[model samples]
Target: MLKYLMLVVVFVGSSWVHPMHVSVCEINFNQKDHSLEFTHHIFIDDLEKSFRQSFNKPYLDINNPDVGKTTDELVAAYMKKHFKVTVNGKSALPKYLGHEVENDAIYTYMELDGVKTLSSIRIFNDVLTEVYDDQVNLVHVEIGEDISSMKLTPQRKIDELKF
Candidate 1:
């Protein structure tokens, strides 16, 4: 009976093990309009509710006075402000797209008006990597070493696939 119970526990526990150290975002740029589309995914240990509560406050009113002034409004404002973005060795200023996924950290989307050809942009303590092209459809995002070696199992077969 003990052996059977142990097997059951292991089976249940195995399904819960997910990658905890990685996050990813997809960015698309439209050079014709001088605009950029950004999709961000982050991996964290906390649940969606906690992540939302900690960062998104006041229920995120898009029309609020404190919200976006000149650029397209962003959903995860806190994440954008803290995360670093660079394009071709220069800073890339991004607007927000007001979508949020609180589970395992916030996954959101946004657009910036003045994006150009970029070489690379990295996020999540540099754990998520994106390489851009002349036209700006994200060429690839290389999930870093820290995430690959974590105890958590790969969430997708793509997770194990690398650049």
Candidate 2:
């Protein structure tokens, strides 16, 4: 009995036990408009889990059409708090442009205008890290011809993308 229990524990602790918890964020610096556009893609299931923890609603479902406005507000508030970016020591408050559900993922859009230059960019993406231990947030930044990417984890919440 003890051997069987130990085997089960070992199997559960393996890589197969880890769930796929990841979010992707794409940022493009529009030279013509002199602004930055942000798009975040997150899995619906992972987002629902995080929302449930934040709102203390165990059965919360963000995909439900009946709770449209409420869910939008929740999502906006959460994104505002968890995901952030600053360029050249100046913080850009993302203008929430709402979100869309495409297949199994929810894609949120935001843009920050009046960004004239970027010597350095600091990204702080905590997304669903608060809810999942192995959560990974991938950030991709594009500036003219130069493009860079970084991985943000719970331990490393912030990262810089240099041109």
Candidate 3:
């Protein structure tokens, strides 16, 4: 009886100790608008920790007025530095639209306008790699009627897909 009790306690404790380090990014090529729409999903707590360490702030409130602007600026800078997309070997500068908190995660939106065609796409995603060693960034791209995906890590940060 005691052995079973110990095993249960250990299982519960271990489950709570480790947090999943993952982020998901979805990219859709809009044929009508000739644009690429990107959306990134990350845990809010993990993002808060990254922001706090980067900005040296005691606390970051996404809902607050002053902190909101600062958060947006930091997010934009971070996204530009860590996330990149290239179409047909030419780098496309994605404009950071905005971010919103949904439940326990934050969704950031970005778009690359005036993209004529997507013959080949190259993605470089390093989000949360600096903070977490085991971070995994998963990207799913939808172009026309086909879809391709890649998993990125610290060692392998870039992936290219040809359509």
Candidate 4:
């Protein structure tokens, strides 16, 4: 009986382990032109591989900038177009995680999700830099803070289904 119970525990624990991550971001709202620029930094245990894979998405041109924007700016625009805040299919926004005001830049910690699926569309906002080239506003996103092990989502498991 004890042997069976021990086996069950091991199986459950091993299978339940998941990859969890922490995200840090900053939003620079230039009230002057009604534009918002954001910078996000993510820190995870395995950054090189995970960052590239997780953030890997198709590039999008919101309005076709004449001179093209930075990679970060482009990413920001793409996010705004595709991402939305929703809790159970309702509108939700990023909540304050923390903040730091430097001499020239004010870094804000706007966390999208403490717990979320890898494929989930959890955060979005306009990348002003994609618009006007002059005095262009921009949003930057970085993924690295801490990624821990947790239970995997049903969808993730299904997606990972192997033959």
TM-score of each: 0.43, 0.83, 0.83, 0.26
TM-score, prediction 3: 0.83
Off by over 4 Å in 3: 1-18, 65-68
Tens digits of per-residue lDDT for model 4 on 1-163?
Answer: 4333533443334344513332223333333433334444322222222223444523322233223464335344444443334433335454444434332222344444433322222333222222212211212222233222212221221111111
Per-residue lDDT of 62-124 in model 3, one digit per residue for the tens?
545255466678788889999999898998899999998766667899999998888899999
Better of 1 and 3 by lDDT: 3
Per-residue alpha-carbon lDDT of model 1 for 16-110, expressed as tens digits?
77422333444455667766566655433322322335446534323232433421333354546444455555566676656553433445576
Q: Could you tell me how far off, in angstroms, the CA of residue 7 lies in candidate 3 after the best superposition?
A: 31
RMSD of 4: 17.0
RMSD (CA, angstroms), candidate 3: 8.4
TM-score of 4: 0.26
Ranking by lDDT: 3, 2, 1, 4
- CA lDDT of each candidate? 0.40, 0.79, 0.81, 0.32
- Give the count of colliding residue pairs in each prediction: 5, 0, 0, 12
Which regions of candidate 2 fall more than 4 Å away from where they truly are? 1-18, 65-69
Please identify which of the two predictions, 1 or 2, would achieve the higher TM-score against the true structure: 2
What is the clash count of model 2? Answer: 0
